[model samples]
Target: MTVALMWEARAVEGRGADLLAWVRQQPLADEPLRRDVLRAPQDRVLVITWWDAPYDADLPELPEPDAELVTRAVHRWRFEALPEH
Candidate 1:
């Protein structure tokens, strides 16, 4: 009964790389995840994360608030990982 989370957030123009670099620096990724969250900025970014655990997956950590990369359009999604199908 593993769960996966999808993290979506908007970044300032040209700040996607910085945002991503910050994400890559989190302790969350240190956990055993199926894959690192996907990141790309099209004027913003739609981050996709996949993980498997005995229970719900924890959301990845965000960078410091001081960075001012937060977007009003931020959102998080959770899903249950299904059996091979």
Candidate 2:
């Protein structure tokens, strides 16, 4: 299994119930959902996803503003993950 570290940051101009509705509609649109998203207060969100197959997670193929957010989100950092010992 493989896991991808995803991240996103959005401006404060648009924050509403519509945002939630839009996000929900998107998960199963073009591809099956395989992600976990975490929010940082009101301006930033991070996502981590797992794949059973090899994937190149470029976001240009997704929705406009969201794809742009993913493209610039930056996903090349490394960190230690503690395993159960």
Candidate 3:
């Protein structure tokens, strides 16, 4: 099975670019099949990582950055891809 992990956070005031750079520098415990980094209008950043793992397997996730970097707590979600129709 494959799992997709999504992590998102909105930077404080004008710290969007700084936050993005911080996240890019952070390393993951395991290498992902693919990864994406997105930026939103409100100084928000979204990171998506695809991994090969069992549906219920415990996977390493990106740790939240320092509290001062963001406007609020980070949000995360995980989903298992369904078989093709």
TM-score of each: 0.64, 0.45, 0.94
By the TM-score metric, which is better: model 1 or model 3? 3
Which candidate ranks first by lDDT, i.e. highest? 3
Q: Candidates' lDDT values, in order? A: 0.60, 0.43, 0.92
Candidate 2 lDDT over residue span 1-85, tens digit each: 3434343445344452334444445553334236665565554545454444335443312243454333244334322234479
**Model 1 bad stretches (over 4 Å):** 41-43, 46-51, 54-67
RMSD, every candidate, angstroms:
3.2, 5.5, 1.0
Per-candidate total of colliding backbone pairs: 0, 0, 0
lDDT of 1 at 23: 63
Compared to the true structure, candidate 1 yields what TM-score? 0.64
Clashing pairs in 2: none
Q: How many steric overlaps does candidate 3 have?
A: 0
Candidate 3 overall Cα lDDT vs. reference? 0.92
In model 1, the clashing pairs are none
**Over the stretch 17-38, how does candidate 1's per-residue lDDT look in tens digits?**
7777666666663454554556
Off by over 4 Å in 3: none
